[model samples]
Target: MILVTGATGSIGRPLVRRLRRDGTAVRALVRDEAKGRALGCEFVVGDFDDPASIVAALAGVDRLLLNGAGALPADGEQPMVRQQKTIIDAALDAGVERVVKVSVWHAAEGGRLAEGAHWEIERHLKASGLSWSILQPNGFMQNFITGQGSFTADGNLVGAYGDGAVSYIDCADIAACAATLLTGPPRDGETFLLSGPQALTHTQIAEKLSAALGRTVHYVSLTADDMAAALISQGLAPRFADDVAVLTQGLASGIAAPTTTAVRDLTGRAPRTFDEFLAAHHEALAALAWAPSR
Candidate 1:
């Protein structure tokens, strides 16, 4: 059986559905019983923080989809490292045969935030002696709706990109890639850099949003230091604010500027475009602060 973690997340939700459509035996590991039932699939109640629950979840499971929470505002520490490493260790003990993990683009040692944290977890997965495929995905187009990336209190798009483009990918595409890797022939230790078909600046993104919403949307550009100062002034932890600020500064030089064929090569189709993403998620984006309040 293939066990999926983070089964309620943007990528995981669609992955479960696709796998079910393909007639794959899938079990979602969820912390909440209600959320798991809402996934409309077989599920096991578990949390990465609870090792015993993970052990229970991995029962009779041969393949594991290892994904969960992401980084948070913490000083020189990454909770993701501890959490996923725990899962890896449990997967090892549970006799799981393979693991497919979701990692960040530019995942390397000494990189900041998710980059650094994912690198450490990837290393652990490799050393665990299990068949593994790693998907290093670029920015998620859903970030705009989730408010995980750049956004103002009034819901205007905000960033330090300085016109540099990012090949933002759809989370559904990422899920499709993971499903392909898990169900197809083993690609042990293979890492795929997943991206969309093209890069777009935040200005272009705002324009697309405007077109979708039938209202003028704006992109506010700020320097890295300026973003940091703004965060500090807003009472965010200073160290965490500076780390994010540094990452914002690096984006001005085009971090995810190039598109890749990993999605097509894995899923046998072109990745979805930004316009398609907006169309698929129009309702969520329409609920942003810039829109007419419910």
Candidate 2:
């Protein structure tokens, strides 16, 4: 049986749905039973924070998809890394055949916080002696709609990216890639850098959003301090907001502005464009308003 963790998240949710549609037997590990039941998969109650629960969740599983829920803190307990080690340990102990993991682009080269954690996880996975594939996808297009990259205000797109370009693949494309790797032949110790068809800057993204929504939207650049303050005002922890500002600074330096063929190479088609993502999520964008009460 195939096991998926973080099954209710952006990629995992769609991954589970696609797997079910493909008639694959799937088991989902969730911290909440209610959410697990809603996924329409064989459900197990577990949290990566609890290694015993994670071990219990892996029973009878031959293949595993390792996905973490959020970015790891720069200095802390490193919950994501700990959880990944726990899962890999359990997988090795259980003799699971293949493991597919979601990592960040340039994780092996490593400087970003997420990249560092992924690098460590990749090292552990490789040493586990199991067939494995690491999917290192670039920035996600869904981040734009989810308030991580940009937000709408009177039909305007506001973000900290300025004019820096990024190849943002849709989360569904990431899922399709993951499903292919999980269900296909065992690719031992392979890494894939998934990206969209083309690289786009914030201005280009705004234009696409404008065209897709049939409204005039412009991209407004914000200073890192300003962005951090805004995010803090929106209820993100001050330290986390500062880290986000740092990440945006890294993006602005052009580190994240590159295109890759891994998505198309694996999926047999080009990844979804920003316009495609805008068309699909236009309504949700239109309905969102910056309510400080949220």
Candidate 3:
């Protein structure tokens, strides 16, 4: 049996569907009973913060898809660093044969924000006796339509990327990779860097949005300092805001320029292009065109 954590999330929901369609027995770990039932698969209520719950959930599960919320404010520390570490410990104890985790691009020791948090968890997972495959993916293409990173309050394409291209990818592709890893033979200790078919700058992205939305959308560039201030204005801690600003500025240097063949190599097809992503998510993007700007 395979246990999928964060099963209600963008990647996990689709992953569960794909696994079930492919005839794999799957269970979702959820915090809410209703959510668990809605998954249409066997599921158990569990929380990363509750170690005992995890132990019970992992019982009889040989493979684990480890994923959860990203960096959150916790007295200037990333809670995921501790939260995922706890899951890693429980997975180890459960005798899970293999674990697949979602990480971020540019993840490394001492890297800023989620990069550092994911790196620390990756280290722990590697040290554990369980086999592991880490998926380090670039920005999610869903961000544009989901109000993740694409807009300012006035509905402009907001970013700190100064004409640099980001190889954004679809979470579906990421989920496909995870399903393959969980169901197939173990590719232990391997880290796959996933990206879209091509790199596109903020200007190009805005143009795509315009064409898709049938309205004029503009790219508004913010400096590193500007991004930090905006985060602070949004009630983020100043220190955390500054740290995110550092990562945002790093994007200006083409940090996500390289498009790797890892996704195709693992999933047996080329990753979706940005245009294809927009096309696949046309209705959602179109809805955004009419919604009130945040």
Best by lDDT: 1
User: Comparing 1 and 2 by TM-score, which wins?
Assistant: 1
Q: Where is model 2 more than 4 Å wrong at Cα?
A: 72-77, 108-110, 152-155, 289-294
Q: How far off is model 2, as Cα RMSD?
A: 2.4
Residue 110 miss distance in model 1 (angstroms)? 1.3
The residue-by-residue lDDT of candidate 1 on 71-155, one tens digit each, is 4643535578989999999888999988999999999997886888899999999988888999999988877776444667666
Q: Candidate 2's residue-wise lDDT over 1-294, tens digit each?
A: 999998998899999999999999999999899999999999899888888888888889999999975553434345777889889999888878899999888785455457777888889888888889999999888776565435633546666776788888899999999999999877778899888888888888878877776777788788889887876765666666776777776787677888988888887888998888877887776565232132
lDDT of 1 at 167: 95
Give lDDT: candidate 3, residue 257.
Answer: 84
User: Model 2: what TM-score?
Assistant: 0.91
Q: Candidate 1, which ten residues in sequence have the lowest lDDT sum?
A: 69-78
Worst 10 residues of 2 by lDDT: 285-294
Error of 1 at 259 (Å): 0.7
Q: lDDT of each model, Cα atoms only? A: 0.86, 0.81, 0.86
lDDT accuracy of residue 243 in candidate 1: 73
Candidate 3 or 2, higher lDDT: 3
Instruction: Quote the lDDT for 89 in model 1.
Output: 90
